[model samples]
Target: MRSPARRAPRDADSLWRWATLSPALLLMAALGLLPVLNLFVLGFFDVRWTDGGSSWSFVGTRHYAALPGDPLFRASILNTTLFALGAVAGQMLLGFALALLCHKATRGRVFWRAVFVLPVLIPGIVIGAMWKLLLNPEFGAIAQVFEMVELEPVDWLGEASTALLAVIMVDIWHWTPFCFLLFLAGLESLPRDVYEAARVDGARGWQELRYITLPLMWPTIVVTFVFRLVLAFKVFDEVYLLTGGGPGTATEVVAFTIYQRFFTEDRAGYGSAMAVAVIFLIFLMLAAAAAARRRVQS
Candidate 1:
């Protein structure tokens, strides 16, 4: 008797699905992957503008090496980290408090929720301009209030010491609403039965929150934290409009530095290198966050 023919494997279905999704995959590759590849390639080249025109020369990792010793670059990195940490910590704390309050409140909850989220809906540039006017030492409302209160008016964006803090405050004001919304959603989605069961076991509100609510909301908190962290690292528009990386290098973030190199100095290749570095740092942060999340989940 002839041997029975072997059955074909089911892998063809997956292949067909991938084929159907090829357009989207190709678009992502072109828009995302291609630019990243070009960026990496350009980072190795030195572009120089001469009297006649411009030229590119292979410079290996020269720009990367130079970055470490560059005071402005170092300051930018430090300031960026500080800004991210301060903004994220402050927003998360304040947001969590607001979320809990709003979730528990019986009266005017909708109004309070709308009030909290209004800042997040505002444009970044507009927010920057508004804050700049409000913080201006000359005729700013804040300065006027300080004068009336017998307190010296602060030049929020005019001093290196206060410029970073000013921007950090603005970021917190704009982003806390986002964290509050996420926390509220997480709280509302939690099963009431779990809390009831805890109460049945003689658990107080604090105990139930500590053991059940926080544990249940851990994933949402992680997601929000990572999202905010990434956005904070790449902050630029507000900083640019608010302080312009002055009164010194105090508010100069990594993104601002990259912009300066790319647009102001016209050092496209060096800016590309900085962009690659930022991308690498982001990947590292994401990896660490993933690892931490897994540890917590396990």
Candidate 2:
């Protein structure tokens, strides 16, 4: 009777499931949640190292207030925005074109695909350093090419005007391959019959692309755009390596600004404030992208 102890009570089953998942939940709380919470707390507090290596107290929103008056911070925000926009636009156009070409190519498709993807496999640091050397005004191959064309050698990393552009070029060279691969995958996964039907309808290449290809590829394009936006917004390594945020904060993206505050100035609390601001901005962007995606899907 009693239905075999009623399966040891359904409450016990729920407890057992909770117990099984506790470790993972705890791990996430420890590694992910705690750090974010700590950063949030630190952002509001004033922490500075002493000669004896001890630290200090709460300055409330002092750092946040100071951000608006900081010229370098303003410049960094502008540079980051420009880099994200330029990189996303350039990569999307080039990637879409490469994807279409690959889709239509009848010979050596695999080889061409491999060639297109080669830049993605290179390490970011190596790409940065390579570009740094290659853009050197004195003996770089690029300088040599300019010389051949009877043009004056350009100081790619020397001046503020050219430094950011140099970083942007390096980023584009490395990341366009990623966008191209994503676009190629999207193109290949589309229904062939649709294209065949379009051909039967006497649609020209441009017409087919505009009407059929782009419409169907919007989701993939959106994904690539969001990813690139996030990455480009957080760009640090190449800018750090190539320009060191010089000539005088011209190429300093937000990440490098935070790094300089945290490591060089040892203002951990201020750095945390900047970092939290960055996180907030990125979250807002991602939320907007998600909303747009949902609208498109609907």
Candidate 3:
């Protein structure tokens, strides 16, 4: 058995650790947990806020029950799913390729890294505004590029067919750099000895990448994939700034849907239900990704 005197120091250290963490825990409860709890509470009721939300009434599961048949909500889900899939896949692939190229280069690595990361340093609102300007129909960036190619000047963000795709493209442009940074970090952390051994055995670039680099970087790939997907699922700020979920709701994602319901339509309860649904979808995605990561590791 350990001495009582020895146990005292360990107990004190544990107390010290919790003491250090208490502030963060309190902050999280106030900022994150309380809002989520309010959303959950509001989800199960009918809340009309003419008198500072004092007009709330218990209408259990009414908003949730109507979710399955809500046309706008369904459209929002479809649009969001499509955007997340397209943007995440594009960003991940482009980012990984760029990371590989940069990692293999011997000169100007810092400059190239900075170039790749520049978009990420910019804010979402600025990116949205920039893209909006670029995609303008007349006398804009895309119009100038179109003139070079002898293509007609077309409104990129004003058409239902192109609006969602345009937003997805903009999202990919801004977030691909984030994925690139993660991939670069993962590539840097890979074991150099294994690559050296593979080279000694006359392994080609493709062979080493296929058999060594990919296998080692699998965890990072999963993490990056999951993170990008989650962030994409929550996309709203840029969409709001650029398109305002317009082109006849073509670009209206789930986040925008909730925003419209709560703030625009004054359906706070329904919006809260949608928020809970978004949380559920995020939880499911996280769970699925965690399971996949475990499978890969095992």
RMSD, model 1, all Cα superposed? 3.0
What lDDT tens digits, residue by residue, belong to model 3 across residues 1-298?
Answer: 9999999999999999999999999998899889899999999988776755458899998889999999999999999999999999999999999999999999999999999999999988788888889999987888999999999988889999999999999999999999999999999999999999999999988999999999999989999999999999999998899999988989989999998888899989999999998899899999999998888788
How should the candidates be ordered by TM-score, best one leading? Answer: 3, 1, 2
Name the 10 consecutive residues with the lowest summed lDDT in model 2.
1-10
Q: Each model's TM-score, in the order given?
A: 0.93, 0.90, 0.93
lDDT of 1: 0.93
Tell me the whole-model lDDT of each prediction, alpha carbons only: 0.93, 0.89, 0.93
**Cα-based RMSD of the predictions, in order?**
3.0, 3.5, 1.8
lDDT of 2 at 142: 98
Off by more than 4 A, model 1: 1-13, 49-54
**Candidate 1, poorest ten consecutive residues by summed lDDT:** 1-10
Per-residue C-alpha lDDT of model 2 across residues 31-95, encoded as one tens digit per residue: 98788788988988888666877576989998888887889888989999998998888888898
What TM-score would you give candidate 1 relative to the actual structure?
0.93
